[model samples]
Target chain A: EAGVAQSPRYKIIEKRQSVAFWCNPISGHATLYWYQQILGQGPKLLIQFQNNGVVDDSQLPKDRFSAERLKGVDSTLKIQPAKLEDSAVYLCASSFGRTGGKETQYFGPGTRLLVL
Target chain B: SQKIEQNSEALNIQEGKTATLTCNYTNYSPAYLQWYRQDPGRGPVFLLLIRENEKEKRKERLKVTFDTTLKQSLFHITASQPADSATYLCALGSDSWGKLQFGAGTQVVVTP
Candidate 1:
């Protein structure tokens, strides 16, 4: 079976520019997540979706960042007016289950974004 | 606030030796602790998961130990090889759901 897939493995943009990313989770996976990994730091959860419904997005910057999972399979994350600090690796992950215990998450290669 | 910490210093060891990495946490009680390996320009791949109730778990040459009392987890790679050179991250389910909080990770370099 194929793993999680993402597009535009690398991206470059200027500050205040807009950018978007796409993700396709593993087949039959029920939970999807987006994370931001800054250099030398672990990935931070930005948003989570379970079958096209958001489960958590408390850390997401609502003012400029937004994400949606349409049809419960494919998802998109967007950042408008990007800041230099926003330059990081955006990773998409999918899990076999919905809740915490015993569920394993599989990640994609990630989209590396650089804002000048 | 909850915090997870891994040694920022990179671990260097000779091939065929054992590599031990530590993960320490504060202000949180996680039911399960997970370990992942990430290569440069790639996403993290899950390696192991040890539960709070379980003291130790092993798979092949990899071993993980969880000490809930100390709120710490240790990951060990036995008979290490150069292929084991990667950044290893420790994570926990921060919420009741599967939302995870990850540590900064410890990079291990296994030299020939």
Candidate 2:
């Protein structure tokens, strides 16, 4: 019944620093996703996880970004050695399941990251 | 490479009128198309979704039409109000489930 929840609604770090974000998805949801949204642009998928296993991560900057869904209920996305260009809102979303067609993604408030 | 596009310019309309936004794609056939509304400082909220086979879907005052041949989707909001003012994004699903390609949103402002 609860919506997706994300922590550290706002984050500020200098370039070359590290930051991490946490998300609690809706109960029973099995599909989770992380997205980066720059101002005036759509949210770009960074990675996707299906119950602790990654399904897609081609867009993720593996050199600096990593995410994990330990127990399939919650997820964490981390960015290390941040660049000034890494400044954006990190959004976490979840869906009902893999087989649910046209499954709507429920989003959290998102964590705003500012790399100075 | 697949590409999705929405009007980069903001759309401004008078309240009680119908507001229409467009999304166009190229180089890929989508299985389904989705629309979401986003406000400043928040994440996008799902609004409507229409499958490739479906030509149109409606919810209350919101309507979405998808044309695979044209590779476009149009989102409409009837009797628009200030509350309807926000950035609307269109998304197309990838071959794999849960992988969606999104378009840059079109900001709509309904002025009374």
Candidate 3:
């Protein structure tokens, strides 16, 4: 089976500019996740989607960040009016929802966003 | 608030040795903790997971121990190889919601 897929492996944008990242989860996976990893830091969960419905997004910056999982198979994360601190790598992961508690997450290659 | 801490400095170890990494957390009790291996320019790959009820779990050369009283987890790789060089991240499943909270990660360099 194919792994989780993410697009635009690298991106660079000026502060205050808008950027968007996309993710396509593994086949038959019912749970999708988006995480942000700053340099020298671990990935922080941004949002989670369980088959088209959001499971958690408490850490998401609603003022500047937005995410959606249309139809539940693919997801997108967007940052508008970006800040310099927003420069980080964004990762996408997927797992089966039924046994998610014990299942391991399969991560994508990730998208590196550089906010200049 | 819950916070996870791991060694920030990179660890250098000769190949064939056992490399052990530590993960300590504060403020929250987790039901399960996980380890993931991340290489430069790529996302992390899951290595192991241990629950609070379980004291230890092993797979191949990898071993993980969870100590609830100490709020710490130990990850060990025996007979390590150069290919095992990577940043190892420790994560916990949130008690309230079971979401994953990750640590900064510990970098291990295995020299052949």
lDDT of each: 0.94, 0.93, 0.92
DockQ of each: 0.74, 0.69, 0.59
Per-residue lDDT of candidate 2, residues A9-81 (tens digit) = 9999999999999999999999999999998889999998989999899999999999999999899999998
For candidate 3 chain B, the 10 contiguous residues with the lowest summed lDDT are: B92-101
| lDDT (Cα, tens digit) per residue for candidate 3, span A21-115 | 99999999888999999999999999988899998999999999999999889999999989999999999999887643755788999999999
Query: Which portions of model 3 show Cα errors greater than 4 Å?
Result: B95-98
For candidate 3, give fnat to 2 decimals.
0.57
Which residue pairs clash in candidate 3? none
* lDDT tens digits, residue span A58-111, model 1: 999999999999899999999998999999999999997655546789999999
For model 1, residues B1-112, the per-residue Cα lDDT tens digits are 9999999999999999999999999999998889999999999999998877999999999999999988999999999999999999999975656889999999999999
| Cα lDDT tens digits for candidate 2, B38-91 | 999889999998999999999999999999999999999999999999999999
**Per-residue lDDT for B1-112 in model 3, tens only?**
8899999999999999999999999998888999999999999999998988999999999999999999999999999999999999999984433478899999999999
Model 1 regions more than 4 Å off: none
CAPRI grade of model 2: medium
**Interface root-mean-square deviation (Å) of every model:** 1.4, 1.5, 2.4
Say which docking band candidate 3 falls in.
medium
